[model samples]
Target chain A: MAVYTEVTDEELSAFIAQYDLGAVLSCKGIAEGVENSNFLVVTERGPYILTLYEKRTRKEDLPFFLGLMEHLAEKGIACPLPVAGRDGVALRELSGRPAVIVTFLAGMWPRRISPQHCAQLGEALARLHLAVGDFRMERPNALALNGWKDLFAKSAERADEVAVGLRTTLADELAALEANWPADLPAGVIHADLFPDNVFFRGDSLSGLIDFYFACNDFLAYDIAICINAWCFEIDGSFNATKARLLLANYRKVRPLSRAELDALPWLCRGSAVRFLLTRLYDWLNHPPGAFVRPKDPLEYLRKLRFHQSVRGLGDYFLDDSATGEA
Target chain B: MAVYTEVTDEELSAFIAQYDLGAVLSCKGIAEGVENSNFLVVTERGPYILTLYEKRTRKEDLPFFLGLMEHLAEKGIACPLPVAGRDGVALRELSGRPAVIVTFLAGMWPRRISPQHCAQLGEALARLHLAVGDFRMERPNALALNGWKDLFAKSAERADEVAVGLRTTLADELAALEANWPADLPAGVIHADLFPDNVFFRGDSLSGLIDFYFACNDFLAYDIAICINAWCFEIDGSFNATKARLLLANYRKVRPLSRAELDALPWLCRGSAVRFLLTRLYDWLNHPPGAFVRPKDPLEYLRKLRFHQSVRGLGDYFLDDSATGEA
Candidate 1:
């Protein structure tokens, strides 16, 4: 639902001529990816996605995102490859915003998260972490533990307005997470926001991963923790153990978690939940009066945060090797 | 910017199974056409547009709209042909909304209107009118002369809130238009809203016309009048006579306008302007708070209405048969 900048035909034509991708047939603003203006651009060469980086995406961090995609694609990971122009540059300017055209991947994001979908996602996530191992660039996770206190500070005053006891609960969770947040774990370029929408599936099979705007160097298991929070929750806010087991088991098969990483799963989940809750809480509080995008319900994440807080151990989240099997 | 209904994988897969088209590879909700929730759905078979009719479009009128597109496409007109399912039904339900899949046309709508573009548009439009002449379906234009007064009544109170004398001016214009509205003009299925965005172009050539939701049975020349208001106006709120002359002349080459039709052009243009002005005015005044779709400025059409009111005769609108060439 984001096509913030309108690219004129003349501007687009001039922009397209810089690349060898044939004459422009059509460029349709597509309702995909929330962070940028995405156009499903079709030329004689075929379909490509034209993404104009919006305000949320930093101009400086684009190279890291683009480079990561190019690197992963070269490593045989199914992802969008940045199409470089004749000047051998993948990134350029269009409509006064940084824009890039990437090869269109044919798949839909699975709307209903199934156990198999989570299993496939776990493999893809693990592969992504391993594939970007040799990539040179590094971007710090902006929504990680280090940034949470500042984010919490911004939304602390109005936090309770979203849910009763939300402010106090968030404060307690943040203090606990900060004290016990795991460090010195296997870190790499993690898709910080590997929500179901960001992971595309061709039927039940994982086709590709997208939306690299949130990709950053962080604890790879923390990425899994984010996924656990996002994917394992049912509509009723209950945790699905089978989905969690599949996600974790398949992920471990690809990239075995360290003992420290395994131990930190529940806390990481809590921290990840709080991270999203704080950001969503901030957005829910700060959105303009007539803004088109409805702020995602912060209470949903509050419920998830509460669930993670109640988890007795990693076993509750289906960490296979853990001593405790259930809460 | 309108994907009001979210179609889940289970729902979409079940829906796609009803059709003979290949398995659904991808379905991205496209940021085209404002009225409906449109998705650029791609499958193993190729690309198609999946339109879920939203609130604005009446469900009962879908048959006429779908039938018109099917009829026009069969007549060798370049437009999206509604793809019927195996049961030979084009219209069906998806995500609790009436939906249809149509063949995807592969060209972009011209962002900047050129004289050549207008010329091409005139010919295509004339051809469209002639092609749909024998089509059995008959849908009365909902925004015709009769509808204008009702629309005006809704917005009349706050009309002047937008402009100084908009209310009084609109009332007088409506009365004059209603009194002088033409009868017995060559009538057929007219694309009531043939705005530039509805017409697609590859370079200077017209590739296709789309969004037949607004197509209806109306005075044939009145469609041309709508076009004159739409394509022949410059961005600075002035009439481009050269563009008008090209459009009218090219249109006549395909479907000749009768003497009565030519004489009635000014009044038709005025009526068309009022029709749009009233609708835009209604939308402008009645727009709900925090509504996503911004109501188009009614002042733009008011300016066009004023221009049409000042028209002396067919000469002002560049009716080619008139002796006053190059005005």
Candidate 2:
């Protein structure tokens, strides 16, 4: 729901002149992404997405995101491929913001996360991990354990405004996560922000994945942990174990999980929860009151974090019978 | 930049089941139009616009709007035609808001209004006035002189907050306009809000016109006057007489304006300016400061009104030679 930079018709006409795509028919600012101005641009050839990277999106990280999409798409993964202009460059500038045109993918992101969607998402996530294996770019997860403490420091003083003793709870969680974080657990390029909104579904099948701005090299299973918290929780903050089982089971079917990865699942889930909670807390405390974007409730992730803390072992998340033979 | 009503995928799928259009490919909330939640809905058939009318749009007015589009498109006007479902119904309830799907029109609304656009707009407007002659439904302009006084009354107390003597200027202008408002002018279904944003052009050709929520049976000359105020004014508030003459001459090439209509142009322009000024003033004063919508500056129209006030006669708007042989 953001189009921060306005692109005039004259600017757009000149900008599109660098591209081989037919004359711009229409360029509509889409109200879907918060980080950048996205337009569902239609031309004589077909519909494409024209994105102007806003202030929040670092210009340096764009090549990594665009390169990863190209890498993944080359491996037969369904994702948006940046359309190169006549000058053979995929990225250019428009409205003083880095702009790129990408091929449009068909399908809507599933609003209701059914078990079937979770199952498909699990397989897709595993395949994505396998697909980007040989890619050479490297970007560490910025919201992982390394960055959590700094984010917490900013929002620490006023954390209790959201809830009683929330600051202490976040501090305790961050301390525990930092002390016990796993050193090695099969690192690879992961779609670190694989929320349901980033996965598109056409009917019962998954069509593609999008929003690779958050993609980076991190623990592959940590990506699964993000999905566990994102997809397996209901509106009432109750964990749907069936969805977790389906997601984990289907994920294992494509790529076997190591014993260390299995052992690290609980802590990974907790860390992932804390990661989102910190970001959400920062945004909730900092965003101007009555802003257009309704800041997501951080407490929802806190409740899930508490749920992960209560889990006794791997058995709580995955029964032995549901396991597809972990490594 | 508004999608106040959220339409779920399940609801949309079920809703589309009643129509012949194939499965929903995608539905992105478009950042356009303040009155409705507009989605650029794509299906296997083609692209279409799904509009969910918000609170500002009265439920009773849906039929008239949809009916007019249907009538206009049937008469070969380049406007979005309402796409009826299998039951032959164009208007239905979705997310508890009156909704309709209309055919998608290509071409972006001109951001920079050129004289060519003005010429095309004038002829198109004249054709639109002639095309809707047989439309049976009748709706009086809700923001005409009848409604201006009430709106002014709402914001008159706070008018001085915007300017030192805006309140008195507004009152005096309202009085003069009430006394001198033309009577017995030719009236038809007028696209009363025909700003540059509502008219789309493709490569110097007028592609289509949109946003009919403000359309009603109003003075045809007043519609031209609204266009004159909208398209002929530069960013600095100076009137471009060349653009106005081109617009007027091209309009006469289609439907010649009567001498009374031509003479009433200056007054109609002044009234139109007042109509927009009063509404914008009301919105500026009454709208929540931190609300999502940024209220337009009413003083812009105030300046336009002042410009119209300084005009000596129709000659000030139209020069000697391009007078269309006016009496």
Candidate 3:
């Protein structure tokens, strides 16, 4: 929950004047998105989300994020369309920060993830991969395999403060992932952080995907691995193969995975786990005392990493028969 | 900025089932109102504010706050009307706390207060006083004179921690206020916490008043005193008598202030200062480490109290000659 920047009334009016979105009716700071200040701005025209990019999001990377959303949206993907000003410039400035307004999507993110939600998410994820096939913009995933060691270095010294043996465990995992990371796979733009909170649903159907701040060019199969870790895990740390089967089966229906991509799933999942674990560990160790956002538990991803380390093959994730049949 | 309660989608849907508001389209936790979990709930019907009362707000007081808003709205005062469910009940349970949905008001609180904003606030405040004259429900101001000593006792030991001699200063001021507080002045339902954030404006006009949880029966002049301290102070701890003059002058145009009420202004302002000072001091000293909502600066009110201490009479706040003319 964050609203790091407070937009003054004068600043807001001047900012809104750039757009065709009528007189401002109300602009409220919304408790969403941890990295940026978000306002649910209502105007004479309609509701839109005005986001002021905070320091965490590099200014240079905003064009790729906004352009990716625009690109995917044009390809018939369900996502927030960046609303440009009268001059047709979507990216602008507000309160001394890079700002943009996007059309408000109507749906609530599923708090209790159901198998149906996983099914819908799988199809949508595959569609998103297919949609970005023709997009020209490219941004390498900054938190991918290449960045894990650097991230771990910052938190390694105090890792054991969170749990005993955590430092050694992370070091070993980082070495293993760095040595075995896959290079040959179907690559495209992937929603690197497609947690349940970022995917919204209206009833049983997927409504939209949001928060493209982490979108980047990476192995598309790795995106599925991220989803399997995010969606298939229960609160008690047990894996639900049924949800994984549905997610993978539905995803393959839209875009068939190559044989090599299927074989690399375990390693991708482990890499995905390390990516989150390292970031979460850094945040856990470094978050300011009395910070509004409670840093996510890094150990949860550690548990996921352990599960991935134990996996013998694809059979450990989903039944081969279920993959052939209807999910 | 707060969203203490995390309402699950299942719980939210079940809660909305009790209402005729169309299917839940979206519900985003908003960073507003420190005392409750507020969501900008948009449905098929329209937008509304779904507030889940936090622990700071007593369960028994829900009826008074909701009822007062309903009463005030019916009396033609622009405020959020508590929306009743299908069963004609506005108050219900959500996420195991008292909750109510109120019609959304469309306006933003002035981030930079101007004299015109003060004038609008003055007229709106007077109208609110007149509108609530017939309100049947009565709640004594819990943070008023009778409650200050007990509040001070909670923080007296550490008062000086905030500033040198603050403990003695508060103790002596409490005693003096207890001795001088007026007994026979105009009394009615007062929005005791009519801070700038609680009042909404569209351009230069007052659109509505909100956050009625602090509404209670008190001397009407004391409400003006609260506004004087809130809307008439500059950010640098300097008092703007021009803003005060515009506020009080416009307020009298709607409901004339009695000579006695005018005479009691200084003491009322001082008492109002103490009321906030003790509460803020208590919050400052008692808030848990790493709490999300930052405790407001108690010293700001200390400065305001000091300013009120130096004022000799109404002349110090405003010119009496301007009271009869246009603000």
Q: What is the lDDT of candidate 1?
A: 0.86
Worst 10 residues of 2 chain B by lDDT: B318-327
Q: For model 3, what is the error of residue A57's alpha carbon versus the real structure, in angstroms, after optimal superposition?
A: 0.8
Segments of candidate 2 deviating more than 4 angstroms? A289-291, A318-327, B288-290, B318-327
User: In candidate 1, how many Å is residue B274 off?
Assistant: 1.8
Docking class of 3: medium
**Model 3 misplaced regions, further than 4 Å:** A321-327, B321-327
Better by lDDT, candidate 3 or 1: 3
lDDT values of the candidates? 0.86, 0.89, 0.90
On DockQ, who's better, 1 or 3? 3
- Residues B1-327 of candidate 2 have per-residue lDDT tens digits of 878888888899899888999999888999887778999988988788999999888889888898999999989899999999999998998989888999999988887889888989989998999999999999988998879999998998999999899999999999999899899899989999999989988878999999999999989999999999999999999899888888888888889888788888888999999999998998888877556666789999999999999987988776433346431
Q: Write the per-residue lDDT of candidate 1 for residues A1-327, one digit (tens) a residue.
A: 778888877788889999999999888898766678999887888788999999988999999999999999999999999999999998999999999999999788988889999898888888888898899998988887668888988888988888878889988888898889986888988888989888888877899998888898889889999999999999899999899888887887788877788888888889889988989999889988766666788889889988888889866665586523221
Question: Order of all candidates by DockQ, from best down to worst?
Answer: 3, 1, 2
Least well predicted 10-residue stretch by lDDT in candidate 3 chain A: A318-327
Q: Score the docking of each candidate (DockQ).
A: 0.68, 0.62, 0.80
On the 0 to 100 scale, the lDDT of residue A53 in model 2 is 96
Give chain A TM for each model in order: 0.96, 0.97, 0.97
Tens digits of per-residue lDDT, candidate 1, B176-236, equal 9778888789999998889988988876679999988888888999999999999999989
Best by lDDT: 3
